[model samples]
Target: MAKTWFITGASKGFGREWAEAALERGDSVVGTARNPDDVQALVDQYPDTFLAIRLDVTDRAADVAAVQQAAEHFGRLDVVVNNAGFGHFGMVEELTEDEVRAQLETNFFGALWVTQAALPIMREQGSGHVVQVSSIGGISAFPTVGAYHASKWALEGLSQSLSQEVAGFGIHVTLVEPGGFSTDWSGPSSKHSEELDAYADVREAASKRPSASDPGKPEATRSAILKVVDAEQPPLRVFFGKAPLGIAERDYESRLATWREWQPVAEEAHGA
Candidate 1:
């Protein structure tokens, strides 16, 4: 029962790892990166199971073409992993219009565009799994990463609604909420806006705060994601990292408490 997968951002991080896992499971993958050559090394490792492709998920026209190419090459695509994303760290007030646009373009609208193109094929086949490599940033707020959080938050909402909309078509959508890992994320992929440097004193302190980059923390992310990829029926949300697990839980608890106390008000809003 081998399956075919189309995964974005396969050059590194969770994308590369997930591509490995999928191949290990005997699945064929069309692993995509901005520079398809970036994945040549991976392609060399698993020649038969992987196809490297260049993809900029933000380009709607090109994205549709990529999906069509995958479906044609693989004959059918069973899984779509939207893992291409980046972070923009800066206070909302400190960010520029261009920086905000770039943040949302890659993290939010890119996923949306890819999903829109992939849905037609999935609907035709009546089966597919769409995995979004999101972050805990989408679920909670933090200093300096407000712009990043906004993009992820938008993704969370879009993916959740997509899950409900595509359920009847046998398409499963899962959101992988990862905190951090031992990757080059802090490099260009996670950049700070220059305009925000005026608040450097405050932002510097925030940056020094504990993150998944701490020793031994990234391993937890690796293990958690592999677990999700192996699940027979993955949940709508798969939280990665020890810190994210706790953060997600607390967020859920507070949301539940609010719902409980305000059920009457909530119910009235919808006439429940």
Candidate 2:
């Protein structure tokens, strides 16, 4: 059966790839981008199968309205992809409060609001999938992207809890943690703080990291996502890319070691 998908940030990158894949498979897509013109090409191509809408994910009201609009247009929404977010690069001290807030607004709260809006519709229909596009940084922090990591970490926690909360209603939640993908996430879509000489080493290391033109392929991501959407029961958390899986394993191992090393201290805190 063909599904109806509502995808945010569908103008480019993984979001665009997902939208294209759905349309090619005979599914209809309600694709949203901040600049409608960015997705005009898709509208021209998919015509009857695609509806391009202008949206700023940070606006809760607008997000809710967009969700409703999409559902009404397609008569149903089978999947919702919260893929509208940008990367913020800078040392913790270098980022302004406003910068951090802006990142959280779009990456964390934006998804939260969209989920909130979509849940009711899904609940009424008794089925739907919500895909949250996080990053490997959500599970492990790196130098220079503290704000971005914080936002994704919050999103991970939110999505995990949401998956449990909505299971009774037949709504599934998926958290996608992608590593070095060939997306504009690290290029035109990314934001950077003012350079500080004190953080030269951090900046230098970050500079060597891969960019949007790197080895990762968006098509692979799209295919993986489609598989997840088609599955009878999708995973709670899915990691993409070789680097992300390796990093996640190392992070969990380090966390286990730290927990064991601090077990005595943790036990003592019980006041036995």
Candidate 3:
């Protein structure tokens, strides 16, 4: 069956590649980006199958409208991918309050709004998939990318709660944690929070070429999605790349050990 797909940040990166992959598989796509013109060319190529929407996920109303438009355009939406996000790099003290919110708005709250809007349509239809384009940072943290990591970690927590909340209702939520890709994540698609003078040295260090934190291959990422989409049951989290695999593995081991070390204290608190 040709499923209908709603994807944000479709102008570039995984969003664009995923939309293209879905369309190539005969599905319908409503693609959105902050700059809608990057998608104009795609819409022209796949007139009957594509609808390009202009949206900035930080804008609540605009986010809701984009999701609603996708549902309405396709008569029913089968999948909604919240892929709009920004990377704000710098020491925490260097970022302004607005810059921090802007990062969370597009990365965390943006996905929240999209999922909320899509839920009604999916619930009405009785089945649907909600995919969040989170990052490997969702599972771990690094120095310069603290802002980006915080947003992704919050998303991970949200996904944990949402997975259980929506399970019995027939809706599924999946989070993609990519290591790094050839996407513009290292280039224009990414953003950096400015220095507050106190962290001038930190900002300068982060601006260096080797300071980029993204690590997923675009083609491999697209392929991973296709591979898992049709599986009998997809996992709540999919971590892409050798780097993430290693990091996630080590993180799990360390956390598990810590938890066991404190098991008696935890049990006492729970009266177990």
Best model number under lDDT? 2
Write one digit per residue (lDDT tens) for candidate 3, span 1-272: 77899998999888989999998888899999878899998889899999998898878898888888888888998888988887877787677788788889889999998888888888888888889988888998766788899899999999889989888878888988887677777578677776577776766765663314654568767778876566557889987676778888889999999999999999899973
TM-score preference between candidates 1 and 3, better one: 3
Error of 2 at 43 (Å): 1.3
lDDT of 2 by residue, 167-232 (tens): 999999999888887778879999999989998987787678654335578888778888999999
lDDT, candidate 1, 137-251, per-residue tens: 8788778888888888999999999999999998988998877667766676887777544787887778776774452344345456556655677799876766787777888
**Residue 72 C-alpha lDDT in model 2:** 96
In candidate 3, list every pair of residues with a backbone clash. 179-215, 180-215, 180-216, 181-215, 181-216
Whole-model lDDT per candidate? 0.82, 0.92, 0.84
Best to worst by lDDT, what's the order? 2, 3, 1
Structural similarity to truth (TM-score) of each candidate: 0.87, 0.97, 0.90
Higher-ranked by TM-score: 2 or 3: 2
Instruction: Report the number of backbone clashes for model 2.
Output: 0
Model 3 scores a C-alpha lDDT of 0.84
Report model 1's TM-score to 2 decimal places: 0.87
- Measured by TM-score, the strongest candidate is 2
Error of 3 at 74 (Å): 1.2
Instruction: Name the TM-score of candidate 3.
Output: 0.90
